[model samples]
Target: MPTETSSLELVGVLDELTPEKEKYSDALKAAGEGFVEAYNIFQDADFVTKKGWKSELSKDDATVHSKNLSFGHVFALRTTLPVPIDIAFRESFLNFDDLATWSENITFSKTIAKLTDHVDVVHYANPDVAVVQSREFLVARIWRKVDDDIYVSARSVKLEHVPTAKGRTRGHLHLGCARFSPDPTDANKTTIDYLLSIDLKGLIPKAIVNLTMAKIILKDFTETKKHYANVLASENAQTHELEHHGV
Candidate 1:
């Protein structure tokens, strides 16, 4: 019952609403390269140790590792979460903006631009902890899925449209990547490998930065695990109640 012109107008509206497929394609390519490099570094046992990646903390199934690079420090963590890969990937990357609500370490987070379904520009700020100063980062992120595994990579990028927030030191994230894969042994679990290279540009001492960084990564994973566990519990409870009522 729609007129030809009305249908055309509707198509135009949908076009505007949908992100351009080719937008930020070059950035996505670069991020892919970075991801490959990070994956290689993390997988190379010798290279990781050569880079001074020492085991900082090992608790339960989670292990945190750290190393010092010339430009900044790098941290890596591996853990298994009691959630499916798709849900873990969505919560960690697609729902990144929602992280501020559940993450106390991050005070502010906003997606500056979504270049495509797989690429975006984000700005997030972390509150000051101990001797560390308040810091913010503007990053370009790219994510992709291979088979059942999902990989996401991000790095600092300068965009004229997104200006620096006042009263916050802009930090440089050389590279950040997270890989989510279904645990082969457990169908309901996902294994995550998180690697990040960052330099909090300020007068903060290296010791303080390293300590805080380690704590932040560990806490982030723990919080994410706890959040999903609670969500699944609540969902199961609701489903049970509905089943009892024959809904």
Candidate 2:
């Protein structure tokens, strides 16, 4: 019998080849797709999501590669929870107000003075580490009234790279998007597609980076779901009580 291989070992096999974009050809390598060759090697490999949530991650091969390595990861997770789409959208994606409450690492967060609606620049500080105010994010967020679905696409941004904060590691997330859609068959079911594409353009090994990403996401998968479920249930009970009293 074949030894049960881990995802990291499979990814290590992929780390051997180097991208030779200079000698690019459609057969050897494509022009527009960044790091396509790297991600393409694991196209068939099986991956486990946070809490076994059945997320599928695939590369979006069309967009031009911005970083040295070019690729985009497309991930989708579908669940039939006993909650309406609007509630799901609010609790899952639009819960910025409750973000610090739900996430254990987030010490502080603030919305930047914006020039327009639906675009938010959020600054995040992680106090667990010795350094203060460690991370920041630039996001474009929306809640569509027509479909009652919520969508957000975000990318990480850095102000002045703090060299003194050696304890803090520089992480890279090239692209990310989230989509919350309602299930057509049932009014109470919903599906969330959280997609990302990361090719860390640094000295760190891709396998290690991959491992870290998986762990952080896995932590969120269980915690976020439970938090939302409880909050929604409480709100629902209040709504029912008010309706019964004719309020």
| Candidate with maximal lDDT | 1
Can you write out model 1's per-residue Cα lDDT over 1-247, one digit (the tens) per residue? 4322211111112111133434444454455556666766656775434456688776667878887665456789987788988778877789989989887778888987776556677899988877787789988787766667777888887766678899888988888888888999888899888888788887777778888787778777887887788767887999999999999
Off by over 4 Å in 1: 1-30, 45-52, 58-60, 69-72
Model 1: weakest 10-residue lDDT segment is 8-17
Relative to the true structure, candidate 1 has a C-alpha RMSD (angstroms) of: 7.6
**Model 2 Cα lDDT, one tens digit per residue, 162-217:** 22234444444454445566778887776654445544344656545454344444
Cα displacement (Å) at residue 136, model 1 = 0.9
Cα error, candidate 2, residue 35 (Å): 20
TM-score to native of every candidate shown: 0.81, 0.56
Residue 97 shift from truth in candidate 2, angstroms: 3.8
